[model samples]
Target: MSVQQMPEATVPGKEYLTFRIADEEYGIDILKVREIRRYETPTRIARTPVFIKGVVNLRGTIVPIVDLRMKLHLHDDPHYGEFTVVIILNLLDRVVGVVVDSVSDVLKLQQDEISSVPELECAIDHESIEGLGSVAGRMLILLDIEKLMSSVDMGLVPADA
Candidate 1:
């Protein structure tokens, strides 16, 4: 779907899986999430981008793991302890995993709670952001996972893979 067709803050009462990376919280559409797994050291790949942590064998299916902190340039050393989790997402028929410091909880945000991301040239890639969500005095950076993962720059998946 085109960015224009992408889900914006206009949608009402949408569920999002909230997770933490460094001090910020990010949310992804709950529908796209398959499952959450404990953090495990994945088999590292050679000559891949730094953000692409590597691949994990999940029930015979090899899933690529992306470190959200690295991908978003959070510049924090990822602590792979008990709290770290890998969010498995099924985007565009492809299964991938994203590592986050910890998952908070699934939140159902109302339309009024979300606001369109401000138009600004910032360090974070605007194209990957769905919007800014406010709840309980905290702001959540809602992400368009499909757009972010499939973008050419991420290199999480090969062009033909």
Candidate 2:
């Protein structure tokens, strides 16, 4: 889907579900969030990438879980604590879960509070970033979750035949 066609939490006050990876904060459009689930060990699949933690049966549908820490090349052996949870997302008509350190809070940001991400080389791919949001005294890396998840490198979807 085109950027303009991508779903957003843009109802006057845009809202984001904020979460942490290592020490940095990130946000995703709240509209794409299906549910927040506690950290659970998933059934492992053979020959998959390390970042692909595996899959879980969510009510019958098999949902793939990706560890954001590993995917973003953050912490290698991230400690799963009480706060660690999976943010299940509905993107491109598929259900996937992203493991995060902990959820912070839902933030509502006005247009002025959000700024374009500066063109720079970063560990996390810039294409995945929607923009940078300044709230309170913190900076949030707002993510285009759909683009990130559906990207070819992510291997979440099959390439066109």
Candidate 3:
């Protein structure tokens, strides 16, 4: 089905795919997720940002992998373990994968559960942060995955896309 025609979750609330980078938990719109695969070594490219882990061949498609931990500067030394997973995302007709420490369960959060991102001076792109979501006393950094992946530095998609 076309992206616009994809079926919504049967439940009323919007769903997010929660994942961890370091101590912090983050979430992205569940609809943007294409698939999750076990972490593998991607072929390195020359002269790319350190955060770009490189590209992997996925069923005839070459997908660039970005390590979110490095991308967000969450961990200075990355430890790739069994739990590491690549969250393949479909953004603006482009497919890309992001490496996260681990994948948590999907959460269906109502509008009231989300709150505005607090004012903070940090290295992270503030605009890419959609909001903060609170659930079961746990805080989740909600991300505008489309905007993050389409960013100019990401070079995954045209900035105008």
lDDT (C-alpha) at residue 19 in model 2: 97
Worst lDDT run of 10 residues, candidate 2, spans 1-10
Candidates' C-alpha lDDT: 0.89, 0.92, 0.91
Off by over 4 Å in 3: 1-11, 159-161
lDDT tens digits by residue: candidate 2, 91-156 = 999999999999999999988999998889777678899899998999999999998888777788
Query: What is candidate 1's CA lDDT for residue 60?
Result: 92
Q: Which residue runs does candidate 2 get wrong by more than 4 Å?
A: 1-11
Clashing pairs in 1: none
The residue pairs found clashing in candidate 3 are: none
Task: Please state the error at residue 89 of candidate 2 in Å.
Answer: 0.6
How big is the positional error of residue 78 in model 2, measured in Å on the Cα after superposition? 1.7
For candidate 3, write residues 102-157 as lDDT tens digits.
Answer: 99999999888999987899767889998999999999999999888778888776
- Mind sharing the TM-score for model 1? 0.87
* Candidate 1 wrong stretches, greater than 4 Å: 1-12, 157-161
What's model 3's TM-score? 0.90
